[model samples]
Target chain A: MKLGPSRFLGRRRPREYAGGGRKAAVQLYHVSKSYTAGHYALRDVSLEFGRGEFVFLTGPSGAGKTSLLKLIFAAERPSEGQIVVLGRNAPRLGPAATPPLRRRIGVVFQDFKLLPRRTVEENVALALEVVGAPRRDNRAKVFAILKQLGLQHRRFHHPLSLSGGEQQRVAIARALVNEPEILLADEPTGNLDPELTVEIMDLIAQTSTRGTTVIVATHDYGIVNRYAKRCVRLEGGRVVEDAPAHGATP
Target chain B: MSRAAAQLASFLRAALRGITASPLTSGIAIATIGVTLVLLGAFALLVANMERMLDDVGDALHVTAFLEEGLAPEAQRELASKAATVEGVASVRIVSKDEALARFRGGVGRGAALLEGLSENPLPASLEIGLADGYRSASGLARVSGSLDGLPGISDLTSGQDWVEGYLRAIALVRGIGWGLAVILALATLLIVANTIRLAVLSRRDELEILALVGASRAYVGTPFLLEGLIQGAAGGVLALLLLYAVFRLVLPGFEFGLELVLGGVAPRFFTASEAALLLAAGSGLGLFGAAAALASESRP
Candidate 1:
């Protein structure tokens, strides 16, 4: 792996950290999660995502792709094994510490998970709002991001009024609005057409270019092939393939 | 901003926005709280007024001691003096047998004819003994009566101790019943608030989950609902206060008139400021606690 300049910069210089880096953005060793006794959602898995690297987590439904994303966000704790993001050791992070870690990561769900009652702008602003960005700055920032996403025209419209692709774009805008260190997307283009999928991937790639460590979990082979990033494929709660985007064979 | 402050601000903003988003539901919740508070307030006022009336009646009561007919005026005067010295006795007055007969005759002028042909007045002379307020208990009066029985020239002695004792017991019983009812009603109020908040939480479960996922602490998620509960409780308290005031305004005049006709005096029907404040605090506390209980129960992992 070739170390990129983007890897060494502090989190403040988000744009300077763009491109492949040697340092791991996230590292998990033998991580396993079970909701109930003897029912494992994820088996022993070890993986590392480098800074500013764009990667695809490909797996079938119930293959623990969502669970993996959740673990990164500290939404679910591992029953066994070490999971670390940034510098914090997860599982060891108490309930009180989880929020600060979560603040460092931005997540986009497959459902676009936008609050239907809230406007497009509000949905994007929600990320900043939760972190207590000043009201005046939040409004300006929200508008700037909405305009960047070409959602300025529908900024005031409720999410339900938007098309599937548009809603997904809003979700991306929300995930990126905070300029977090790591971006985790679960099936970001799951319901979109191929063209919209490409557009979303381009936006995600652009986000990585801005120095966010982007990890997208999806079943879309076209997205993985077109993007030509690192790919980590999962099967039956275990990693089946981990390779560079072009050279990967499953 | 400091982290906790920042988190609190975020929670407040989100909660305010959420409540504003569903104005109709919030309105209903506030109204429910108000109505319940009003019911409680009205009940409290009724209890307060009943207690006041009992106090007034109790204050006027005195024990009457009838003497044997053979006791002379000197003996009656001595008895009065001795009665006044008893531990519970506030004051004592001697009533001669002739005066007693005259009073009886005056009470039944036409009926006095039914007692014609009586050779001598058969009525006993009496001493009226007023008891001190603190020592007006049945047991205390019984002690006085027992000591009076040992006095010389007191062939037969009678006091209104039995009736006074029964009245005291009745008052205590009524007060116990009133308090029991109040407690039951308060619990019911708490249940109502808890159930309402639980529904509110359920309706916004997705929002709460998202907030939680995004690093909103349990307190942040719970505070808005707690505030909602406080709002509901305060509104209810105000409503109850208003309802009580309205009832007192509308019904008190008629009640006072009836009481005046029966007891020959006017009585007031209003709670003191302290009493109202206490009631309001109680209603609000119940609301806040109920909501807190519901939130705590739901938020537990």
Candidate 2:
């Protein structure tokens, strides 16, 4: 399948590279993962995501979309392949190297996984606290991001008290608080209503404009179709189609 | 605040938050630790004072010569007078059976009532002799005992030197047992705290994974639990010290006169500054150790 830039829909076009020149933000070569004998979750899958690109990974249940994203996030090691994330060799990075690498990357899971006992702002500020950022700086960044997400009023509320959509936004806010170079979101809108879905997707799509590489794994075709970005469809542990943005010349 | 100071404050806050979050579990853990520390403190106090008592008894060497039952009063007096002139003997006095019985009743204290039912005094009259200063050394004492052996009309001799040696042996045995008990209790503390921390870790497993995902270091993820354990242990130590002080200053004093009748009234001493500090330090150190053990065994994805 041909892959190229798509229409920006009146937004600033996120820069796209013509071919491999600068190192990819994420690259997987011949990657494979297995839980037991003869049941591979991923197999010989090779893909590259450039900096400042927004891509969608689409598949039905058991289609390896989550596995592929997890591999890139360094949450799981490949059985027999080389995976490089933002320049460091993933498998060789060891335990000591994961935190720094993970700091440069942000990941959002479907469950939100917000600390229930922490307040909304405290939950978001956790991203800054771990890095030993100054309290004033952490507070400023947390509040600014919360305000941008329309969550300033709920900053002091506990996560459990927030609705599903609000919690997801807080999760996203936490992911983007540090201005990470890469963001991996898995089914971020799976539990949201239609209107909230669009709001969350738009919020996520807006991050690409600021030079953050975003990869969203989802089964929602309508959402994917509307956004009209590069889409990689996975089936049975392999990439079946790599389609570029709609209305772009191949 | 400085960066390190800020981090410590954050860690402490997290620990306090955790403690307050599950008061039941934390309370149970803290109570278990406090009781353990009190037991350790009480044992230490007992052993320290017992050793002091042994030292005092060791320094005052004396010999007792028992006469056969129903010995003539003149013969007892003659024997005591002769013993007083023996070389290395400082002084000698004869004690009647009545005096012996009175001393026995006094030593037994509350148990003195048991003797009231006795048909007659079973005690034997004897000569109580003190050793001169030169004969108080171990060798000198042994030599005096040898001289006293097989004296005329003397049935059996009890030497303060022998009792002192026996007391030392008993003290050593007791200390060995105390150390063993301390070791066992320490191991129990570690296991209990480790299990408690492990449960705490499990309850917050999602948060820990999130922290790890957000680029928090293992040390960062584990520090708060370490602090939790340290606080629990140190708090338990403080509680134990309070318990010990209450026992020493309030409870044990009421029994002082009775105890003096038997063990000579050497009151149990409270732990010194260094000893109390050690307990606190040990409590915190064990807390850290327990958390470390739990972290080591944690199964990370």
Candidate 3:
């Protein structure tokens, strides 16, 4: 894979060099996350995702897909072992360092997580606002992404007023507004009809062509088969299958 | 124009939106701060007037040194010149025994006939020592009185030091009570404001989660809430200022007699513009800190 710009965030990030020109965008080394004394959300899962790679996390209902995404974003620390994201150790990124790291990655949820009270444009602008982007630039960037998602006309409308597809599109607009290097979508199309599901999935897939590592966690085998991308199947918190994409990914 | 300004504008917009979304709770917080400031302002106004009257009285304060019996007029005049040399003594007037008697007689009104029974002048001759303008407070009076007390021909000395001390004590007591009340009310107001902002935080938990996912730092996510509290507090300050001014103008007349008792006919004055601004700032501080306390108590992403 051709190297994109290294946006490993601030100077304090550990293993920032991560030794020259490595292509791995994320690497998990026997990572385990547990919430209870005898139970594990993810148990000894090790995975490596290269830059610009598109992968699907396929699993049953409680198969630790969300946990993996959370760990990748530094939202959760591993109970054991190491997870590196964007050249920084995921578990060691302190509270101050996490946001800038997360800034380089975008995560979309099943519920579309748009602020209901804010207009669609404002919801998307949140990403840029956090980074103190100038208002004009924030507005132009937000408009460009909203236009890309084909929801520019709904910019002033609140989330509650939009259909689920449009709402999900707004969420995607927010996630992509900053042009993140990594895109994680946990069931991006979970609430949509099959038609909207493909529409959303195609939009998410288009991001990988721009050299963003894409990870979509979903239980629907139909989506897994349709995309035929590099697939990492998880069962009982462990990777059961790692299949290469049937077609070109990057 | 700049990114920091843009962020500030964003925070302000969010704060206004939060206020508009829950006008009732916001209004309650503002009203709480306004009421607290109103009582505090009232005490402040009263103390200000009393202190002003005290200051006005400072100009006329004097130390009187009574002459010993049989002191000649020349000796009395010499004592007056000597007292004039003391520090903080602006001037001295020697009132002879006959003048003192006459003044006493004239001051007794219709009862002057009773004083006529005394064949001789009974009042002591004294040098009335006027204090320098700057030397009128309790401490200043003490300094001048101390110097005049041991004069060669002077048997006794008296001044308004006791009265000045009493007035200062009264002012201190009022100021102490006002500050104590301010502290208690401010605490209550802060808690109420905190709870109000806490509810706002709880209501917007989803928005916060989204922001967090988008790489917003905790400060980024918490700023709007803090701004909301600050806005609420500042508005409350404005409310209290208006209320206090209205009362000063419209309602203070009914307490004319009370004002006379404290100010001695001196016109009451409202808080000056700078003082008013200070009150507003205090309100804003309370709101900002209240929001901070609330945010600190909250568990955020």
Candidate 4:
């Protein structure tokens, strides 16, 4: 049922997502984002996440983790540097080009970002609707994704009716439903208990296993240690450490 | 289907949802549009009817040259024939004193009893001359009247040109005021629509930002608001048309009759199809512009 990439139809396959093509999933070069004069949220940060890699961006609050993720999603542009996502210069993408770029990258926020007024199925279908995916295919994909996330029973319920874990899963379903080339999660497990935290972490790990380059940002070193992925640490808007997780092979 | 067609359908659905979500704002906007359009339509109808009345008077183009009180029948006939031969003159008919008296009685109707005290006919014999088509203008009528005034056995000349000039001035004033009001009302409608749509945009900024973030283009996000504006504008126009029809059918006839009492035989006029269609188009234009204004202001970083 899948037609080939038609850019005008918003169905173009980005380089990283196209059948295991090898490319930098994300690259930042001397990137800086400042909200106020002389107050940098991220300053001269250069980083890279390889195709099919799982990485964690670990930082305390206000350590520019969110700002860097936003740059990857093209939500915020670098003040004085370049950001390349899925092999496209993210900061240079024109307004018309940005949405298609965003479609190839999935993002989950700390607050879940699920629409409270929409049912779980509707929330997940939003990604498809915006791109004009066929209605029948959208319903099938939404149901399949919801089932994969173990939220199939709650598909008809509003986000407000779900627990924190279920809602976060729905948010993840929305993010991953389009099979994006890259997944950026900013503290997805921030509000969950330890049991739910491990489940969400494992779910994200599974996507990385499917060759979707996944970057999860958090201040929680416990999950980072348990999952044992490569870790990049940030402090005061700069990367302080970059290494494999404690139990992971180099 | 094409991506744009799909997008349009989605936007329309969203726009309908938006309207249903906020009843008060949408109602206020639609009501404001209706009121503004009604005022404009009424003025247009008034102007149309007044122009019709003026044309009815102008088409006759009659000027009466009164013969001297003691002029002989032969002399009066000669005066009438001479008036007919003037360059702009179409035809001339002589009215004797008896005919003048009979016309006056017919005009006064029941009030003709008041003229019974006069022993002899006090009205003068006159020659009523009709000007040709091109001579009905102010300058044309003036030239013909001037020539008739110099004719033999003529004492005075009178024409409806003065009345036409007065009516023309009234029409000019009405038109000026109508246009002035139209501009003011149009601006008011624009501002009202813009403000209302702006409020809707502000209320939904978070939703819009999310749409923007989730692979929705500017058109995808903004088209629904544009549709909202268009629907609101069209609804207002339809309401105004309905109200105008009600007024024209139920309330205007009595007023028209009273006007006829003062200025006889003038009939009321309503909006023609073309005029109504223009009003609808204008209303939709207002809606589109208002939505555009809202979208532009919100697009700022």
Winning model by TM-score: 3
Candidate 1, pairs of clashing residues: B33-B236, B34-B236, B38-B240
Error of 3 at A9 (Å): 23
Compute the lDDT of residue A121 as modeled in candidate 2: 92
Clashes of 1: 3
What DockQ do the predictions score, one after another? Answer: 0.35, 0.62, 0.75, 0.49
Top candidate, metric lDDT: 3
TM-score of 1: 0.82
Across residues B72-133, which tens digit of lDDT does each residue of candidate 3 receive? 98888887888888999998998888899889878988999998688888889988888887
**Decreasing DockQ order of the candidates:** 3, 2, 4, 1
Candidate 1: deviation at residue B31, Å?
7.6
Model 3: which docking level applies? medium
Would you estimate the TM-scores of all the predictions? Answer: 0.82, 0.78, 0.91, 0.86
In model 1, the runs with Cα more than 4 Å from the true position are A1-23, A35-39, A92-94, B1-43, B109-117, B137-140, B143-149, B155-161, B179-192, B236-268
Off by over 4 Å in 2: A1-22, A245-250, B58-159
- Model 4: per-residue Cα lDDT over B237-301, one tens digit each: 99999999999899877686676843458777678899899989878888888888888987877
Model 3, residue A113: C-alpha shift (Å): 1.4
Q: For model 3 chain B, where is the 10-residue window of minimal lDDT?
A: B1-10
Q: By descending TM-score, how would the candidates be arranged?
A: 3, 4, 1, 2
Q: Report model 2's TM-score to 2 decimal places.
A: 0.78
Clashing pairs in 4: none
